[model samples]
Target: MSTVVAQTEEPEFDLVEAALALCGGDAHATITALLDELRFVRGQLALSEAGMSVGFTRGWKPRFEIEGDT
Candidate 1:
């Protein structure tokens, strides 16, 4: 009888560890930076959606609309 064995490979580098290293091992700073980047990306997406014509977008509505933005 033959037995099957499973092998798992680990990543060469950890992305979270790399980010912490880039932030000088400061977890708070890394989280803050990530949140800032997320906000910037969301703002850019909102702007792009706003600039698109209704006809071009096929009446698609943005999911991130803020109150008083319409």
Candidate 2:
């Protein structure tokens, strides 16, 4: 019997494809830079229609809402 190796799964960011498209196949400048670009791309997405429902949309709000308005 032979052993199999596992591979990593892709990120779940719906707008990731857009960021990659913006990159246009350029070599990643840096890990931080790539993340920065992605963040910018995410913000752009939030401005677009249905963007909030896409993948993961970040919103500023209080942590852990109080139930029953208590």
Candidate 2 regions exceeding 4 Å error are: 1-29, 50-70
- As a whole number from 0 to 100, the lDDT of residue 2 in candidate 2 is 100
Clashing pairs in 1: none
Clashes of 2: 0
Alpha-carbon error at 1 in model 2, in Å? 60
Worst 10 residues of 1 by lDDT: 61-70
The C-alpha stretches of model 1 lying farther than 4 A from their native spots are 1-11, 54-70
Please name the candidate that would achieve the greatest TM-score relative to the true structure: 1
lDDT digits (tens) for residues 1-70 of candidate 1? 9999898997698889998998999999999999998899899988988799889989986776477856
Instruction: Indicate the residue-level lDDT of 11 in model 2.
Output: 73
The local distance difference test score of each candidate is 0.88, 0.59
What TM-score does candidate 1 reach? Answer: 0.58
